[model samples]
Target chain A: MGRHEFLESVAVADCAVEIEGDDLDDLFATAARALAEVMVDPATVPATVERSLELTAPSLDLLLYDWLSELIYVKDSEQLVFPVVEVHVTGGSPCRLTARLAGGPIDRTTTALRADAKAVTFHQFVLEPRERGWRARVVIDI
Target chain B: MKTLPVGDCVWEIPPGEKPGMRVPARIYASEALLARMDEGVFDQVTNVACLPGIVRAALCMPDGHWGYGFPIGGVAAFRADTGVISPGGIGFDINCGMRVLRTSLTEAEVRPKLAQLVDALFAAVPSGVGSKGFVRLSGDEFDEVMREGARWCVRRGYGWPEDLDATEGGGCLPGADPDQVSQRAVTRGRDQLGTLGSGNHYLEVQVVPPGGIHDPRVAKVFGIEQPGQILVMLHCGSRGFGHQIGTDYLRRFDQVMRGYGIVVRDRELACAPFGSPEGRAYFGAMLAAANSAFANRQLITHRVREVMGRVFGRDPRDLGLGVIYDVCHNTAKLERHTVDGEPLELVVHRKGATRSFGPGAPDVPAAYREVGQPVIIGGSMETGSALLVGTAHAMTETFGSTAHGAGRSMSRTQAKRRVWGEALIKQLGERGIVVRAASKSGVAEEAGFAYKDLGEVVDVVDRLDISRRVVSLVPIGNIKG
Candidate 1:
């Protein structure tokens, strides 16, 4: 299934989660797609544009926040919406991520941002590895 | 979704729910109301429970909603001895609140010209994103306004001392130190004073509903409807200035937090010791922002009074457009409250909450001491709002606090998708409620359905004994950003 379908399928009341390929790259890619699920018609976000992302952090959870925040910046500033199509996770204890993103012609019709999350708060934020893959539980400040 | 019985209407969040919790979170809601609560709200409150320096418990009100740091309906008291003040707790729009005005005009006179009055108000009130005002000020002048609060507006002839009497702390906190405020805040605030910034901010015309008041004497004192008497209520805040102050403080707090060994549950909850230099600076700047917000509302009142006079062909004073009560929803005030029977100076941070000083409280104005401080809760314009009075329970339970409004239920995107602004406006107009909006999008963003039911929210407060209902108000006209 496409990233959009995965996001829609995993939907919780206020959040959604997804598990993808067995690498850090794919994990970060899926995470971006999850956030995209909130902002627009995720299906419409194409892999037309490719961009490289790099983030280093002291903690794996903080790394995840920086990753999501990076994608948000790209979406908000560059108007590029992407369903993270690729991923690669590296580094120890505190992880680093490298990924590929795609999208184009940002949907101008999306007037109200899904949620203007104020910040990525540390409250109840956790990143854990499950039997199937990796999972993250982070609360966005809204 | 599980409930643990606490007092009459309180529910506890058992300590083991989240391992990191410093204290069990409690909610003030009836069983019936709790059943309908969105599960995300529970999760959010749980997150709040994990924050550091969270003394007592992370409390959520009946109006609780998912928010940045603390739930919109959340309340937590930190220990002054070893506590922190989070900007996320007070919200970005510091001191965003409501001001209710009592008018002599009966519902009879306002009904005829409600539409025109609403339109006039819409035009006069600057709203929407990046909305500016005609009363521009230089940076230096803006600094004075920030320091003085509503007194600045009153000094400029926007209002009188009587208005101050009805406002919290006479519309200005003494700790406001303009020098603590950054230049960016001053720039954003200079021209935004006297303007109603957008997103849930509005000017509403209301009529006290029939048979809504339990006390005829109290109703008469508050100028309640004899079936159709009219009142004006406005909700807004310090605008760009407040937003900038919040942003600046959050960064400063984040940088210095480690030095103070203040480990907050959330970075959004970043704070310094109340007595620390950083904390004092934030308090000073926050006070300035609160004062600026007070001045903003004060000026809006003057403008509304002007428009009312012109629209009705009667002087506003003659029409009894007197200030009833103005209260702040987001602020941290240094006050002495009895904690376990010992009086101590504490920095009370109220976010998405309003102070409801009970009758006879020394902090309350002498004029209102007998009746209790009026608590004006502004519901979304298309929904019903309420007027309540502080109860002794407030002082004992929630630190003299109560919910501010119908907390948001849906995200703006969801609301925009589900409700069209044009259709919503038409529906309201058909219902005899005239609405004037800065933009169609703004209207949709603030649709009543976008919020939790105010009736339900008010019921929780009344049932919980935090505040007692004084009257219910039905909207007649609306002016929104």
Candidate 2:
């Protein structure tokens, strides 16, 4: 019901939502789930391939973009859809992130495309941490 | 359902007509034609009214549509002292427009040779995305193209110098300073000249209908006919060169406006003062792009003439294939117009609109001064294209501008979802129109139903006497990119 709270409370853990676990992990996992939902139907993904990935970006906005774009690359090439369970944001030169994801072969009929994104554009995009949780503000290039 | 008469075909919104409008808006559509506009059309028109330096009104042409900063069929001439130039105004494919050619061949003689002629044209002209042409240029040669426009191609024997007479700005804007263009733009443009890039760009063959003939004597001189005479029309622009030029300038202008303390309601409407360094830089680059587009079309015309000759087994000279007119749709030109009583040098930005200067206008070419400048409007593949001439009415109404084409009624996604590409192709083929496209999906995106009926748009403009209808050309064959 509360869009901001829902976006903030999303977490990551063990490649799936840890409903009764740490807030940060659950938040990252939820963000990944949100991304996966937009890309394709998570229910249809076989979850056969276990993938571990890391990314670094200049800002939280860039971090979200890098994360989403990287996942999109994997979706296009590997035909894998990943629903995150755990995510750890570690500080580095830019900023580093580790995530666990799940996905499998793509089936177009059963999966509805949520958006027609040509490419991620650099418009008025921003990512920042809020008092309650992490928040990302971005406009998808459609 | 409500119409506030502005003047002639123009209608005013008067500030609070719609919500979120910082200023009033105007639409250049007759009451009959305005009724057929898409429901969301006013929304997009009002959205533009909220932009910065939008001047007296946010004007929409008969062919209006929802687009990024401004609607596709919208035009707003921002004040030179304060206005902004949105990339949305020029569009992603900068300077994309139409070039019409007249030929000696009548419909009867050309109809039989349609297949061979289409084949020749298809093979001769490179189409589709990433499609390259037989002609290629290096960075230096490309720079020459940016500076000389169609003349560069003519000097190389692509076409005759006379062809320049029928082109807007004589096929090259005078103030093209190549130094303002970026190296990346040069690189992208170097190989793309004379090539028809993908999506909505096309080379079409049509038969001229007899009845709507204007200046039959002159038409006779040009070899245009009454019911069925074959003609060639090319719709394209500067391609990657123009894209890169617009991109480079849009970003530069976006940042440059900060120095001038100028702010717009929308970032897409980013701009700098007309006299500022960035504004001059953008103008120079835009001109260079316009030149590249002119040269590209000139080369394509030459190839088309060659192919017509090869297919007809007669010299193209005898075939009477010559340029009727070449014009750009999205561009900003510097011209002198009387503001109050004294002539003032003004920067006129005509986006999705064509310059329709009437007879006796000094700016119009000498050959066409008697009949006025020929304005070619390329319609949907199913609907035929129209030939129009400038009218005296347009001079005071809309800065001598008229609607460019049948504006899109729906987005590509909606069109694709509703219509299948192959089915649309077959439908066209059944209607005696042959179409060749690079991507099937792309074709679906451009389905005739995706846009307003061009016939209606042209009719409104003609009825209003903004531009006089000269000819309606029904397509026989088309190759789309």
Best by DockQ: 1
Candidate 2 residue lDDT tens string, A1-142: 1122112111100011111213334445655666565444467666777888888866544555567555644543344577544677765568777887766655543443332221222333344455665544333322
Q: Is the docking of candidate 2 incorrect, acceptable, medium or high quality?
A: incorrect
Q: State the TM-score for model 1.
A: 0.80
Which tens-of-lDDT digit does each residue in B80-121 have in candidate 2?
665555565665456778998888788788777777777778
Off by over 4 Å in 1: A1-142, B50-53
Q: Report how closely model 2 matches the true complex, as a DockQ value.
A: 0.06
Candidate 2: residue B237 lDDT (0-100):
80
Residue B109, candidate 2: alpha-carbon lDDT: 88
Model 1 docking tier (incorrect/acceptable/medium/high): incorrect
Tell how far residue B475 is off in model 1, in angstroms: 0.7
- lDDT by residue (tens digit), candidate 1, B406-466: 8777666566778888899999999998887755766776788777789888988998889
